[model samples]
Target: MLSNGHAHWTGDDPKQVYAICVASLAPVVVDHPQSLVVGKGDPATLLCAAQGNPHPAITWLRDGTPVSTSQDDPHSHRMLLPDGSLFILATRMNKKESDAGTYTCLASNTHGSARSTSATITIATLHSQFVVVPVNVSVTSGQHAEMSCVPPRGNPPPTLSWLRNGHTITPNNRVLVRQDGTLIISEVLQTDEGEYVCVATNPAGIRRSAPAILDVIVAPFWVKAPRDVAGVVGGRAELKCRVGGEPPPTVTWRRAGGQVPVGRARVVKGRGLLLEPLTPQDAGVYLCTAANTAATITANATITVLSPPRMVDMPGDVEVEEGQRLFLRCTVEGLPPPLVYWAKEGSQAVLPAGITTTEQVYLSHSEVAKAGAVGGTKAQYEVATAGRSDSGHYVCGGINSAGGVMARVTVHVRPTLPLPPPIIAVPPTNQTLPVGVAATLRCLVESAAGVGVGHQPAVRVSWTHNGHPLTNSPRHHIRADGTLTIKG
Candidate 1:
């Protein structure tokens, strides 16, 4: 007999008959194809292996479609090897017919058929040119600098790096390479100036950007600063300032808190600021500024205009009655602000005895005093509740290194006079009334003013009934203006 294309003989005698039997089994994959990545125009291979009762036949499929092997078409680039592997002579990069996709192998025999796990095929490529490139840039020393780059499209996205004058730049605290492929220098120095190039690299190839030039400029600095100057009124003054920088800087002059004097002030080309016939208003802080493309610098100097101390507001004579307040005012103006003091006549010592003198008389420097005109210091001497003994000749004096000034103020304290007594101008008249009727009386008194310069004398009125002083009661009402009323 014959079964499954194999011969088997059986007979009555066991020693005369011979039989051969073989078992059938479905195919099982032992090795599946592996994923692979290859450059365009490069060779690739996908491997598969299986075991079964009958020797299995192997075939390949790409993206769920059967692949054409060299046996089916001799001109095809893909071939099936005897060892159940797929070989490609050359990979194609065409958009529609590319040799890159998912692939799998099928193994079959008379018993059954088996399929293998999918494997992926990838093609790597990199463009030749960059999308964005670095360019020339100019910045001052100690300023920020940046260069941007966008690498070409590539498989596995390219990495970016920077090269300065053909040498790789290592990232440090000041130099950094950002995630977006930008090179940044936090504070650029003079040595950082050079030609820069951007490099892009990937599995396929490396691409370099065009060279970019970086220029570092020097900022303006002071070579010689102006010095403090002292000038008398109607005298000339000059101030000089010198500067240095890579690019020539421009020099200008200005008053710190005010504008430079327009007519009297002049700027010399190589020299500095010049002022002819200076005035008292020219005394202030002056600034010399030097500016360039890189930065701006400034220096200041004080201009002091000297003038002697003179009285702007003079104190005059004052008179007051006993127990009255008195004040004397004196204001003086001078350069450096003269110190002010008050003293009584025939005394060289400062007034109020033993206390230090200041710009404000008898008041602490921080105390608020009466405001005087601009450039003038005001001094006031106050006497609270004066008496006859307080009368004297007071002098207000101001002194500074420039000169000294003095002004006298006479003060008189007159004695207070006594107030005259009140006299009865109209006497009360007699009134007679019957029972349950009211009686009215009228009284008027007058008083004379005091002889001194003070308040007037006050008069008070009262009534006596039968030698007894009358007061307010339910029956008797006293008005505020000294009027009396009786209720019946």
Candidate 2:
């Protein structure tokens, strides 16, 4: 080998000779250090990887020591990987108070060395505690019930739950729990009567409080409801109801939203609503209510007050010839309907205004309907064949639970003609028609052929329009069919 900058190769030590342009390397740590906080008895990981032209080596240390620096640790807890990273180089599993401290990660290469910023690792202790106690709940049946539980916060907030009768039921239509740990029952029922317990749970453990008893008393109820009743005037009426509950319930009665008038004859309170000697005003709706310490129930009924009968459309005395048929018609309106009859006047006959009819003949019973509809009941007496002996004083009577009504009509027997009122076989009503349309009007007659002994005269039907006779015209015609027609 030449000494002066001139290369003269000598091969005695060939391994000592090398050729290179140039190589420089320096490790640079990751720009940031991570501070770690994990639960005690848990594992923690730290990273200190570096970058350089040549791959850097990773090393973890505690308080600048290559030896174990963890307090009271028996052995090293680190595991280094081939890629220059480790699970725990100076750390241990199941970390304790002594394991919580500043740690450093160092990386090195042929060019230079680098180190990470101090990382503070902390091991947190977690626990849960009882904060509030749920007490025994006593709520009346059919009332709102509310219960709650409170627990001290943990590392994480604990989950809360409520249970009944040792079984956990979720919040539903009947029961619900709020985020604030309140269990609410909108309407407490018999099924809600049981013991309750509050349960608290966290990662640390679970705790259940002592059972809190829930008592739900039975609510008052109506066993027998008041039914609608119809009572006669000057009669007695009564209403009753049966109530049962855990505690004796109070019962009261009212009429038409007001108190039933109290009197010796009308005792309207208590269960028995006695309307002795009821009047027309005593009829109305009534309410009966039952109440107890738990709840209340009500029952109601209608009271229909009835009145006496009254006669309508009475005829005056009549004169008819022998061998004539007579038609006796009478109508009466009253409450509770009535039974009508015809009585023959005798030497000792007398009439009273109550429900009493003596020495009478059965005629026909009438249909019951609203008095305001058509007429009331219709009672008709017809004599198909008659003689001089048929004439007499005839009394028509109607009787019901309220009272009686009667009317008398007298007749004379002679060879005289007695005009009879015309009864319509066809009734007429209004109608609408186009100007060019044809229309008809009909009128039929009832026969009174045997009404008198004399030869009867022919009957005639006349037409009237605005008080003037409607005569034959180009648009109007009368036919034998008793119809009036108009030509279109």
Give TM per candidate: 0.37, 0.33
Best candidate (score: lDDT): 1
Superposed by TM-score, candidate 1 places the C-alpha of residue 185 at a distance from the truth, in angstroms, of 2.7
Task: Give lDDT tens digits, candidate 2, residues 393-419.
Answer: 988877877789999999776655666
Cα-based lDDT at residue 153, candidate 1: 90
Report lDDT per candidate. Answer: 0.79, 0.67
Off by over 4 Å in 1: 1-25, 140-142, 154-156, 167-172, 189-193, 216-488
lDDT of 1 by residue, 1-488 (tens): 77876666655666665556677879999999999878888899999999998989999899999999898999999999997999999988786688889999999999999999999888878898899999988788889999999999998688999999789999999999999899999888866877899999875677999999787667655545788998866787888887666788888888987899999999876648988888777777899998887778788998877655677778578899987887777877765567777888887777773332245332222111111213457777777678787799988888877779998888999878876676777777777778777666666666674232354435666777789999988888666445677777
Cα lDDT, model 1, residue 405:
93
- Model 1 residue 37 CA deviation (Å) reads 3.8
